[model samples]
Target chain A: MRTRWIFGTILMLTLVMGCAKKKIETYPAGVSSNQQIGAQTKPYVTNHQEEQTLSSVQEQQGQTVEEQNLQEEKLKQAQQEKEDIRKIIAKRIFFDFDSYELKPEARKILQQKAEILKKHPEIKIVIEGHCDERGTEEYNLALGEKRARAAYEFLILLGVDANRMQIVSYGEEDPLDPRHCEAAWAKNRRDEFKIISSK
Target chain B: MKKFLLFSLIIGLFGVDFGWAKPLRVTIYGPAESKIYVFVAEPINLDGKKNSIMVQEVVQCIKVKLKLFPFFKQLSPKDILEQGKINDVARIDYKKFFLSRADIVITIGERYLPDTGKTRIELRTFDVFKQKMILGKAFDLTNQRQVVLMVRKYLGDLLQLIMGNKAFFVNPIVFVHKGIKKSSIYQIFADGFGLKKLADIQGIVLSPSWSFDGEKIVFSVIQHEQHKLGILDLKTGNMQFKKLPGNSCISPVFTPWGDIAVSLDFSGSPDIYLLDKQLKIEKALVKHWGIDISPCFDQSGSKMVFTSSRLGNPHIFLFNLHNNQVERITYEGNYNTSAVISPDGRLIVFSRLTPEGHRIFVHDLKTGQEKQITFGPGNDEEPFVSSDGYFVVFTSNRSGKYKLYYTTINGDGPYLIPTNNISTFSPSWSWVEEKYF
Candidate 1:
């Protein structure tokens, strides 16, 4: 009879401990068991069930706030990455006078742009072709298109989708440098990348 | 014997043999020796009123108009007055002008008619050598603004009577006045008066060409980094734009059939295409893997002259519409562009880049001869030949800033066209009827 009583007491103790642990787990990770107990012992006259419901609601509210913060951090990180992609693609590649042939440096820059464009499929860009004032307005327009097209084709070869790019020719109209000098012309003869759309 | 002695004395005073057998018909391309000496007499106030400013303005207008014809040498009014005083003649003395070697004498008489409250302007042109009046016209002016029109009309009649060609006086020149942020199209008289701002476009306006009827204009507008084709209905003063298939819209010109021929790259290359009146693509006119733009058609529409890079460098090519044969007309220059063909399709004027700068050159299609017409310290480009094929107007930076300068087809007198300090370019000269102005 004594041995049986001891076994029965140990079994009761295990069952009670399991029930308390389950009750604590039901509350939020932020709501400590000590805080729950302190809330239950408040001097204000209140229903016990109502007090438990209020604490549970508070725990849920706290959990939602923490989830919102994590989501905001993720959104901020995405925006930063998008801005870095924009800066990289906005870089300009230059060309020679009256010629649309891409130089080695231009090719290198275009490769980097293509990689960014590939990684960011939602981005749509316009490749603007520009020319120096040395050529006539009409011919320079065509030449500028050729320059833009050169860079565009090179980007396509580097695995950037052709549909993601459009081309325009400014043709001695929009100059980066307005001075009437060789250096200014060299700077003006370039291919500029513009981000049209980014989702 | 008195008449013979008088003639001999007149010949002796002038020191040149005076031919009275034929009326002096100043040939359009006469040599410098055959230049007609024109004497514009001082305006005579019929009522003896002190309107010296009006008189001076009228005289200045007449002299400026006369200067357009390279074959006419204007004798200073002061010198002519001094010569007349020496001869002691109050009225116009044909003998004194004939002795002074003045081939043509223009007389102006202004009288204020109080009955009608208007000024009566009587203009008469006398053949000095023939000793007879050739032409006379009178205008009733209600205000001073009509003075320019009256003078232009009188000169037009006089020029037609002399050279049988008066297209230059009636034609208006359209050009772009580039500003700091926006550019506007302006229409001015060939004599550099009547500057009217046609349109104040928001962005850059380029390559404005007049239709054959002169009632409409087609040009390219670059706004917000997009090139669009703009059509201006001069009759209603309405503007319409078309976003073409490609990003390029350059050198929009009117074909003789009233269609638009412009450069577009919708076909993966910059090629010349024909668009209908509604700005829809009719067909591709000039297509190549290389660059082609600036297509200018002759009056008959039988031929077109354009700048193309099919042969590797930018050169002017002539495309025959009848045969559809593409022949490269320019062979010398590595960079030749902005070509315009004469109305008769005989001459092509273009700009060729040289070591110094861009200069204007004329290539005769028949003779295959290319002659440099403009020698510039700065770039002189965008040559527009008049419909009469006698005058070539272009834009030049020879005066530190680009201004409109006009010269004869033979490269005579690239006179500055005053634009009131604003830089101008892309001159398009067309003959609109007098009623439009």
Candidate 2:
């Protein structure tokens, strides 16, 4: 009679501990065991049940190792795509008000652009000249023209062919930044290069 | 057969006629009689020795000089004085003048004084039905060569007074011809004829604006490594430059009197500054460190329309001098620039960049309505309206080259000025002289 009672109590204790672990896992990753349930019950039960099923399937099939490795490779490929997009820094050049003369900073930016162009000669580029809102419509137009020409000249000096490059002046017509603040103006007073056709 | 013919003839005599069925005249006149009547009278020279050529000759000369002004229907000089005495300045004679359909009669009297050697040409306006002479203003001139000019001036003034608006004959346009690439300003008639170079500056000249009298042009000239704003006398070749503090001045427009409203970058970003007659900075119109360029004064000079980047976008803003308040005028486009306000302040012509391309747009101030002015394959921008508010001057690359083009205010096809492909832009119409007005 004593031996039978001990076995029964041991079985009950084992059932209680397993039930407690299962209940704790059902609560969620950050939940405490002392927390009250019912009103605080979570929807994490589905994940826990799915994990239990998955573990049982893994024990039966033992293919989870290769599957997890494939997933890791896909994640890495997606991250590489994101980093590549970020690496393409859009370089903007600027000129003096009403002038098309390229300053040293503009030249430095264009030098980087030139290397990109040289590396990818198959790409076609467009140089757009813009002005800060100043002067008359016609005057700004002429100013924009001179600015585009200045950029075109520099790119040609760096081996970009006349046929492969096109220059357009937005005058004060196209502003990248559209605020009435200094930040917007600083962005507007620029010459931008767009790769019209890239390999 | 004889009996049938007789019956048909009898029926035909009483038949209803359809020939009298014409368009019904909508008698909007009602019982209320028309009050204002316009009459064109014969011109008379009072101070004889005929200082002017005959009426036909004077009219012909004006039509030749300004092909845009409509041709005048002339009457004999002898009939004008007689008509003035009998039908115009005298009693009502309602039955006679009303039968002749004359409610207001115009009498042009040209007088030449031998002692003063000045032609006292008087334009006598009469309210025939009221039996009142409204105006009898006289102009002084030296010779017959001045007759066509005098007639143009007097007729324009009379038309404005009678119409209570700017008469079409007076507004002239002035612009800089940069395609010819010379530093020269040219004046053209409204119809694009009578192209005359008003001033020949030795350096780069742009932004030609008319003075209050329309006889002077204040423009920006980059000469000797210095930017100068000078008032060029239209009739004479005399010019006086306003000394600017820096070489960064680009556009220079005139306010009333000799004061100037110019864009100066001395404080970093280009802002609108009021320079007195002495070229001293009076005050700043905008406080933003960003651009506040292209300041055009309203007809009243109490407000200005300029482009400001203060709202984080480059848009046209109106700065009221009285309130010192700035209001954004455009909201439809990401980029709106190069806006020129109409003389009446009822409309503004600006450039708006959309997905298709940059296009010239006219925004009506009253309705906040915007309409595209250019629809071409390439970009079109830098719109400047004519003095009479009938046409505009702009730059377009639709021809595969950037060139100066003009179109009617209604956005008709552009007329190419003779300037070549020097990438011309920023065209300003000069004020029409009193002769045209």
Candidate 3:
């Protein structure tokens, strides 16, 4: 009876070890960026006010679980595509307070972004709308959509087919700078680009 | 006990809908502004059904209903006794009341009949100065819930007699409660009792508007994970999800005619679209370059007022349905939105952004005069008016979090609507039509 009990414990330990090993093999250890997307500043804003941009998240040792989880999701989606694919469609556009009209500076950035989409005809992208936490969420959601639609329309004007891009509004949910200062709000009010499919 | 049953039986038979055109809906009557003095005597037969759920439920419903009566100064038995006063039929002194004046005294008695299994309720009222019984009625109710309903309608009639207007009380207010990761819709009584959570949703729920009959609710639940344009049936706990063509959709309002209108980003921009009950896009109501949202149909369902940004800033615009003429309603404020037309269509209440913060304002359409309602610190948004246009409910983050608040048309009391947590938003009051189904 004692020999049988010892044999049972060994079998249970083996099963648990096998599951952990399989999980490690499936998931990448950590997503590393060749460029510091953190230090990139908006060409539209001439001033800086926020203490830190949400992009410098790697330096913050004690991060909130929500922020960490979001990082994981963003990184996992990024890791799925090749390194060259990410570099092409990584640029994003920023907006003024409650304004959807693209600034003169933003137009230059979109000129570059539109040119990349023109080259990668097989790639479909999602234009995500983001907002600062200054207004009620529902209204901000509407504001975010107007921002994304502004970019989407501008891209279409730049000769990109409308069907090549899909739009989604995160409203004030996902902030690039999650703080209460004016600078943070300006940083957060932006539109991000994600490569959905590259066939 | 015998008298209670007879009074209720007579009311249930002949006097229930005396002047109203329909049995389901009642017209709004003018309410007297003078404070009413009412002293409630302890309910009799407390020892008989001391611990019964029937007695408790009936008592609670009565308390909640009484607290909402406008200008009601309810004096409990303990309050009267604390002043060393008894509810004597005669020789009752007006000085005993904390306030100098006393108007009427109300007393309730209840009994159970085993033979017919009917509950009997006795509601009595007396004039303080005349020292005589002004109203006495006995109601034989089939169940405890029926007694509560009968009493509510009975009080409505009494209010009409006293105030010269019969208004609808005892209506429920529905709102969206936002939580940590998710939010859901919840319903609460106007008097802050009977909080019932309808559903626990996975995504953020916004703008829960009640249907005409109060049977189902049409709301937008954004869960890209698991969503609903969600026509939710209240009785059966059933739901039908309608995924309309849009990147994001919000701000759903039901017209008096029952066709659903909502704001959707369909044509690469957020525009108002009228949808059928099944959530099919019937037609695009308004097409604009900038965002067009918060569509509120007038009581006649002929006109609409919504927020638009064609001028570079969001402002309220009025749309005449017949002529297809769009006129800007609010030109004073650079930023104005969330305007709901009063059922009477004579006034409008909306939120405006100012240097102080976002404050509520009431706009008289006829006079073209706008008055600020709230002056507190926190931003107040999404103000809605009750059926009679006497009370306004809005979402305020003044209490450290976003909870519901209510004030009179004149901005009387911006009292906090206490909930379990601060998560209520985009409150819409139920509207009543003159013609009832």
lDDT, candidates in the order shown: 0.82, 0.62, 0.70
Q: What TM-scores does chain A show, candidate by candidate in order? A: 0.69, 0.55, 0.57
Better of 1 and 2 by DockQ: 1
The pairs that clash in candidate 3 are B7-B138, B8-B138, B8-B139, B29-B165, B29-B166, B30-B165
Listed models, DockQ each:
0.51, 0.03, 0.22
Show the lowest summed lDDT stretch of 10 residues, model 3 chain B: B21-30
Better of 1 and 3 by DockQ: 1
Winning candidate number (TM-score):
1
| Candidate 2 Cα lDDT to native | 0.62
- For A22-47, candidate 2 gives per-residue lDDT tens digits of 78766656756666465366544467
State TM-scores per candidate. Answer: 0.83, 0.48, 0.70
lDDT of 1 by residue, A71-133 (tens): 888888888887888888988998877789999988888888988999889999999999998
Please give the range of 10 consecutive residues that has the lowest summed lDDT in model 1 chain A.
A40-49
Supply candidate 2's per-residue lDDT for A195. Answer: 66
Candidate topping lDDT: 1
lDDT per residue (tens digit) for residues B25-109 in model 1? 5543333325788888767777777654665788889897888777789887565636442211124577777777888887777
lDDT of 2 at A180: 47
